[model samples]
Target: MSKTHEVVIVGAGFSGMAAAIKLKEAGIDDFVILERKDEVGGVWRDNTYPGVAVDVPSFTYSYAFEPNPSWSRTFAPGNELLDYAKHCSDKYDLRRHLRFHSDVRTARFDESEHLWVLELASGDRVSGRYLISAHGPLVTPQKPSIPGLDDFQGHVIYTMEWDHEHSLDGKRVAVIGTGASGLQVIPAIAPEVGTLTVFQRTPIWVLPKVNPPINRFASGLLAHVPGAAAAARLSTSAATEALLLSFIYNKQVPFAVKSIEQLCRAHLRSQVPDPEVRRKLTPTYGFGCKRPSFSNSYFPTFLRDNVELVTDGIERITPTGIRTVDGVEREIDTLVLATGFKVLDVPYDLHGVDGETLLELWARDRKQSYQGVTVHGFPNLFLSPGAFGLAGPSLFATFDLCHGHALRVIKESRRRGATRVEVSQVAQEHWMEKMRARVGHTIFNNPSCAGSNSYYVDEHGDSAVLRPTSTVNAWLAQHRFPFNAYRFEEPSAPAVSARRRATRAAR
Candidate 1:
């Protein structure tokens, strides 16, 4: 029989690490973190494409409790983020609780036993009193279903799973999808590739990247000064919150959106000399409809003699190159898919009460949860960044808020000696209604967003990505939600009597 732990956390990414750290801080140690891969870093470990760096400022990207004063740049490179994950793991001593290469195939709540039984791909079963899923939004890479993509004879690369072994030097490269990943990868590879062609479906809002190196003096001040790091984090967070408000309440604050659009247009005009090229690069939709990126070099990369932007629809990918609807075929030696990841959709099978899987429930109705942590039928199952759970732009801040909520609930369950804890269906529905009302006012529902192809809108035509509330409100709610919203169940009388008899006999 598998030994049942007190808690089972899936994924060893930053979120999972944060979960483990929180559990330990709350004096709960009987927990195991199951990681599918051999390493700790989740997305950071997987995505190693060229010119990969965090768009969020480094000061605000890290945990509030564990501030790093040694960031090389304002927007640190991908490897630095990976290193930070490792650093946190080592500092927190999380390795002892981690089980690497343990891919969870399915998680089913055994109501009779009041525990979550996780079936691993290795034919192993791990049971726990509580389950916390930290499998983040960007776990699975999305491959475009372009016709004849498989027939391409040349090298192929997905931005998430970039192959550094293959050299792009002097090679004819074609990149598809000009989203966040494309914005970064294009500038990095354009100068090196012989000829580069970028296929665009929708143009994205590009802001100027103001990344700068952290000089020794500044680093020392952040490290040695009393409140330097905290102050920097606060200021950066304030700026991000303002930006998020601009997206969430675009109708109420139209000037913010207008200012941002004007800035993007001015940036485009200043960078690109050709009006035609600038027009092709401009986005037709609202600024906040789709996620935007910051780049100092993306616009200038188009001006390169060898780089060409193809706005025509991709008909199909031939054996040698891509064919457009205009009947033009561009021969390329390598193809890079900068398409984004699968968001909101649960990537794995998670079975709850009555054998109803989370994927099935969400697909049948809609993705929702109470405070983005607990679902109605899922007992003691906490999800990080669940539907409408994202409160802010910074992922680290979101992790802190979501995990903080989960930890508080788990602690409450322990306080009451409850073996099962699930949110009330009424409470869950009430929360969903609140989110729906708030999201209705956001820019995601605007008519201009119809053609943007924003992932923020789900298949049900609902903006289920963000929490539709201010970060401050979300943080306060995490600590202030009523305990009656959850149903806590203790063990049966017979089980309690048996335990009492066993204790007496031992004594």
Candidate 2:
């Protein structure tokens, strides 16, 4: 079928859904939300592992237009969160615009038409005037190269690609990596397993998740007063951003990083009676240096008699057991790898601007974008959570901010009668340098945490993925789509440029 939309969105997660809703609200229905999965909720729909929950509180994790007053928990689990995404999609009439199971294999920029040609998996080609890549970075799975892993006789499961049919009841389980996924998976599987051995590459600071139920009275008040939820979102976003700044912007900031680390250490020491276990679990790096985890139950779960924390690096994987660097062989019936996603890298083979793949273009430079939305050489293409994906305490804040930012830019482009707009290389380079400098000051890339392998930092040891600001700040700066920072072409020139791009695209 030959059809075109004014706006074409990839990935129906928070960003895509929010974009669709925003576009519809602005009376732009000639758009489509393309998703590879049969349903919406991109990552949330895919990752259904036990103990998988949002790191932030539920009150501010959702879209501003729709709030779930009835969230069962402060940090809603993966399933509930997915349900919330779907609920929002349905509520805002976004499902009608979603083309489920439509995987866009390649997006070619047609210079002549001043549009994007999306080649889908179903052998259908669609065009859109504006392309929004809400395709988040986390969907890509990264597996470790453990020798003999393929020969494992027992069931092996990767956290991202969780197997619903597989059960760990009464089985000896060996969990690998103590990252966010590790903390979540361990808590869920500890009780069910006959024995649970956790493999930790590096110790992580895990703060107690002070998650509590959203009170009924508060929900009612929010429903009536309205500003209550908005106020909570504002307050929470500020607090989260402040924490980030303390770690990076002001390492000397009083009680900034220490406060959280101290709390985590205390929790670990309190939970584990054995001094040896506590030592093994405690991180050597500054707490905020790594992606700090939040879970009150993770430590308590490890303290159980069945759980064992193994800090030794892995030597190799045997068919029936794992051999640690210390030559200790831990036999288990199942291997659960909590290895995190490719946060710094964009996995898809995406090529933009004369056949330069996204990875290759950003290889030496880490990722450089003006305000995390517009990149150099990619005209009319906007990415959600792009270079400065890290922003706001809540993903919802980032989602809304990005959607709002992109919409404002789109409107500004239309108002100026511009067909194509790309961020200036100078602006992008300056912005990228600033972010790299920020990461350099933060605890995440400090010397202590440098040796630790984490998806948090890039090859250049920069936290370009996260924005070190609040949603309000990001929106304030990006709300109007800085045309001054961009070089916009009149409609005629872009059409000619489009023809050239189309010729290159054909090649």
Candidate 3:
């Protein structure tokens, strides 16, 4: 007899871990979390670059269930964040239920049996009544095809895949792209490297990161005094909620937001003395168009004697240096491509139900889901922050909320004796069109800025990647799985034989 499980979660990231916790809380302990990596910590485990600190405040970035009473700092570093994930896994006893070092290659459902058969990287298969894909969209690194890229006789590394063993000391480094990763890496290794050259296509809006360490007094009050820690958590939550309110209802709260830009501009002016250099780095797009990065050190790094910020477009890579459009060759021993991930795009030719692949179905103009959970024809599947984007500063907090909400949907399906849950074509189309309409109204579609640093653009290069608006609103709206927005299908019938089950679907 084939071993069966209630659920199989792919990826042991924030979403998957949270899902396991929520499932356990709901008395559903028959699930197994399959992680590709040997250890836990999703993106946190992958990205170990220097000066890697989170932009979001520490208090609001944690799970509601397991709030940390002792946070070292406000803007937690990567080590702290990864430790928190490990701590969560331990506290929740999630490690025991995880199948580490296992990757899910493909998951196909037997509609009749109402079961998901998952194919693994090891050529083994597992079947489960439910399947959730928390693989996420951010980790996949996108390397742009530049001419003469591979032939360069130097260490070419993507920021996502950093070489911890390779020494950066005294090596001439060329850091490409100026996105979030770039912002983090530039300030960190700039002082250490021999000669650092930064190649930026579009300058992003930089904001000051108001990070602070938690004093012993504050920790004591939280640990000893009743409601002190609760009060702190409550205050942070209110502040985040206030910001979310402006985005959804007001859409133009100039005070709290513009003040940040003014602060950023002042910081930029102080760091970059040359007017032309400052002008080149300044963004003309609205503050929130691209992902607003918070850093106290990035601008200051540019001021370093060893760091050279180059504005010239990179034409190609030569034998020794990068050949810019200006025909200037900047010599470098190491190349770090911080070109960012393929956000608006996913892996190749992902086909869903009726043989309609996800890339083909949503290829034309939009990426839609029925309440950011399920898509039409793609039954027995769910994704974190899918149709509607997640709001708030912390992806961890957002994923925890999403996982809780998705757990409800799962329980609902089980309770109602659903063989497979699916979204109606009408619901999927309506949701997609409505979201696109909302996106059309935002500054994300700013007529002036499209090509520069936007992953929001679709395959057509329109800033269609994200709505180009409020992160808070996107987070709150996807808090729950709108059951009415989807359709549920009962299992066709339990198959007595494998041949019979295959025959039913192939027809």
The TM-scores of all predictions, comma-separated, are 0.97, 0.92, 0.90
Tell me which of candidates 2 and 3 scores higher on lDDT. Answer: 2
Using lDDT as the measure, what is the rank order of every candidate, best first? 1, 2, 3
lDDT of 1 by residue, 1-507 (tens): 367899999998988998999999989999999999998989899989999998888888888899999899989999999999999999999999999999999999987668899999999999999999999889887889999999999999999989999999999999998999999999999989999999999999999888889999999999999999999899888887888999888778878988999999999999999999999999999998999988989999999999999999999999999999999999999999999987865567899897889988988988889998889999999998899888875988788888999988888988999999999999999999999988877889678787998888888888888889899899999989999999999988887787589779979
Candidate 3's residue-wise lDDT over 355-471, tens digit each?
666656666535677655666777777766564545454566557646755776777788887767777888778767777667555555545445445776556544433333354
lDDT-better candidate, 1 vs 3 = 1
Off by over 4 Å in 3: 237-259, 344-350, 460-484, 494-507
Candidate 3 minimal-lDDT segment of 10 residues: 243-252
Clashing pairs in 3: 351-357, 372-387, 390-475, 391-475, 419-491, 456-464, 456-465, 457-462, 457-464, 457-465
* Model 1, residue pairs in steric clash: none
- Clash totals for all models, in order? 0, 6, 10
Decreasing TM-score order of the candidates: 1, 2, 3
Residue 406, model 3, lDDT: 70
**Model 1 regions more than 4 Å off:** 494-507
lDDT of each: 0.91, 0.78, 0.73
The digit string of per-residue lDDT tens for model 2 on 352-429 reads: 767786778778666777787778878888888788765776666777777777787777777888777777888788
